[model samples]
Target: MLSPSSDSPADDVIRALADVADLVVVPHTRLADLTTLRIGGRPRALVECRAAEAVTAAVGALDAAGVPVLVLGGGSNLVVAGGDLDLVVVAVRNREIDYRTVEAGGAEAGGAEAGDGDTGPGGIVVRAGAGLTWDELVADTVARGYGGLECLSGIPGSVGATPVQNVGAYGVEVAQVLHRVRWFDRATGTDEWVSPGALGLAYRTSVLKNADRAVVLEVEFRLDAAGRSEPIRYAELAGRLGVTPGERTDPAVVRRTVLELRRGKGMVLDDDDEDTWSAGSFFTNPVVREGDLPTVRSRVADRLGVEQAEQMPAFPAAAGGVKLSAGWLIERAGFSKGHPSSSSPARLSTKHTLALTNRGSATADDVIALAREVRDGVRQAFGVELHPEPVWVGCSI
Candidate 1:
């Protein structure tokens, strides 16, 4: 526990919260040390909550006192500004996992299920603390002969962030298997479980994103009982698995293949790989109105030859728009992999054009500068705007 010498309202709140069980306060901690981007300055204080109640209590106290609060988990999808920040960081560290068998008609078995038939005909529901690493939960289910999360393997972040960001990879979004979420409602001051419908899950975004409406305490995801993976929807993944699109495969194999693919693209974290030092896929695939697709394509055709323009990837978004590949637009706009130069502090990832990386010495300014250059270049070349996917704190591109 840390005690501040001053009598500031923020410091006083920290001192009072330190007395609460399962909560510890630290005087100094940097967002760079906590976030995947490894770029950001220090917050006024850091409150490490070891239990869900502590998270609610700490956040509630800070909120009531009119102090700014940042609910931090794995810090995988955040871009914090450099220099001393004015907010207090509530770090969620509680980790507990339970799996229950769902009886017919949506009934849950008494207590946590165990034994060979754990994955009954009605399927299994995994209840994981929000603080648990997202990949760890995926790995555990696969190890237990379960499925549904294999396509999402190799994604970095906490279980809580999955619903907040509606995290998806290889064509499987968290919305597909989400059972329910236990969240602490900031407005109501109540903790409750809500269905996926309440989340407003969309491509790489949710209502919980860019807002402090609620704090997720835990998450439950439904899994396949028969040990079969979700139908493969990503063309590259299905091709690698030697199966047609929408065909199912073994969960273990899916996990392995996804990991290999991610590593090759430098999406997986590795200390020695500077390419992995990125906030994974800096921009969301741009979604254009159905009526405007032709104009964008015409622009593409005019710049790059007609053959190359026709080869551009565009998927029909569920939300009534055509989702164009951000990476494709970036490359076609002339920002190649490792854009700018090898010596620049912030450059595009050598393996993937979508990821803007920090090469050991890049500041938030450097990363922001690169992002702006790429975004502006794409907009100028294709008449399409690329929006950043990560949540920005005290900064914007």
Candidate 2:
């Protein structure tokens, strides 16, 4: 289903990379087949790079030709457009896990990355290649009595994509333990290790997540070898574990609890559950100015009664802003879970209001249509504008 564009520059670029490495260069790979949302259209070219060198070569060639390239990892954090997409996709599939050099102690007090748990050494660290499944890495870490990543269990994506989005769950973000990332720099045609700060890791955003700024080859994480979890900070998780905030527990226990919680919310992907067929949360919580909080509150009061408005969820955040739950606002706006008609291909997850799902037959347009409907309805009912959480390729809401 490759569309005939004026230029087939991507094919020529991918060919050069294949010549240099063991890569599988294919044509007309559909984006819908790669993403969890099961939407999007076909890409002009798709190159599956199985090694770190292959990833660099492919991305480098595409950059030289000025062909737009989408770095595909787990394909879980993306929402692409329909029809023919004007880009090539370079999928990173190199994977390895080395826990040999870890230390027997806890992570450095503050936020310094811990060493590998290599009992015989100065420091040991757990090393995972970019293509490793995120949850699989979490499981391995927890199994070995390491902590740092327990709260991130069940997140759907690859290890490489985690740092790209500063992936976080249950009050823990990848920034807390990301030691370093080895990436291919398209601008300089050089590969090097860079710190998290260099990537601008903040609020579900990173330089790599922006596009093909760089293709991450591998990532290293520092974990506590003593097997204790990172200090629990989220209230719901802390309550479930029967611990107070800032308390640490066994990493395995935390991982289990987190996976269970994610499953209940349909955050964990399940083929049988149409509701789980989504790009996780569709909208991030809206952070509004403190003064605008009163405006949002009044809007809720005018729509629903004052009692319901008083019950609306709102949390104070830094810099005179308030974080309001997008789910709460959506539900209060009369769009409940499984909203609009269930007969449609796109619908809100029956278990979680924040997720928009594809019921087997949804096209990119169907999901987009539902997203717009919910987003517009919420904006009209409440004065706040909700932003989507996933990265979009050729579509916007």
Candidate 3:
């Protein structure tokens, strides 16, 4: 049983996969080439699987051979250590999409249309292969007058990564639109489609997150066919679209606004912009106990005065917890945007305090050092912990 892991000495596996018409094995590619952060080490081998069967076969063979595998999607939400990583990269490239309009009273999508404006029930269902770029999906839906994904516009990464993180922005989460997911279970080596309930979807996390238990093959999202966006919820996004809270607007309008807002913050990827050379937001908003909010509020009021504290972004969370903005906390903790200096290789994005960027020559060590500094600084100032939002490989905070 040969695997493609060169370091594992999988020459036999490489030879075996050469006969696989659906799997293309590209040797000697670095993780840096595949990831957004532009930092990472070389993998043992890079295997591109363009179909479900190819993916199933590649992963199964590698897993059975006792070789560690890193499944690469858009590589937008990952941070890998520099140097030679002792693992194989199984990159999923199977991209196919099917769209259907679900007529009124003839569809089931985990309550997606239940509270979607007042457009009366009917919606659209898009079944997209996991490898499709997330923003591309959003753009297509908006172009076709379909809604539900507009709020998530400008988010980097692939469709498969969405359900894994329940990726959200502008008050819309993938959990809200996600209806079903087709996955390859590693344990049983079987393919199956499961509902959202089975995924344990939550804020920026899901059952697949950090589990390495299953591979998402495809995803199905329920959208509003009436071309209306999901009810405007996030205040900032609502204001930009000129819609009151809970009011739905044109999907195109929402998409354009979201992209503009993202660009302003350097959240959208731009090859010429170093500020965009980041893994999006560095940390998730810290969700804390409700009873603990006042203490943190006082910390804010103490440093920035009462007026600023009152305006600090604080939202309700599950179990009466309060979600505090990580960006607000970082800036308040003395880590200003572009902290220290702009000449440094690894610095916070000038446009957004939340993004820790690579100024062209930063290494894994530089990123880790800066991330630790920000995380520790916030904890020391507010006594609240900041958890990283990206998946770290061969590194830890």
Against the unseen true structure, what C-alpha lDDT does each candidate score?
A: 0.90, 0.83, 0.86
Off by over 4 Å in 3: 1-11, 104-121
**What is the total number of backbone clashes in candidate 1?**
0
TM-score top scorer: 1
lDDT of 2 by residue, 1-397 (tens): 3463545876667656667665888875788899999888888878888888888878877888988888998889888888987888888888888774443353433343543322232333567888888889999888887878999999998988998888988999898878778888887898987867688887777877667678788887877766779899999999999999999998888999998999999999888988899999899889999888878888999998899889888888757788899999889888898987779889999999999999999887888888898888999999789888999888877
| All candidates in order of lDDT, best leading | 1, 3, 2
Encode model 3's per-residue lDDT on 87-190: one tens digit a residue.
77888888888886665665545443332222235767888888888888899999999989999999998888899899999899988888788899998998
- By TM-score rank, best first, the candidates go 1, 3, 2
Candidate 3 structure, TM-score to reference:
0.94
| Number of the candidate with higher TM-score, 1 or 2 | 1
What is candidate 3's CA lDDT for residue 128? 89
Give the CA lDDT, 0 to 100, for residue 11 in model 1. 82
Native-referenced Cα lDDT, model 2:
0.83
lDDT of 1 by residue, 135-175 (tens): 99999999999999999998998998999989999989998
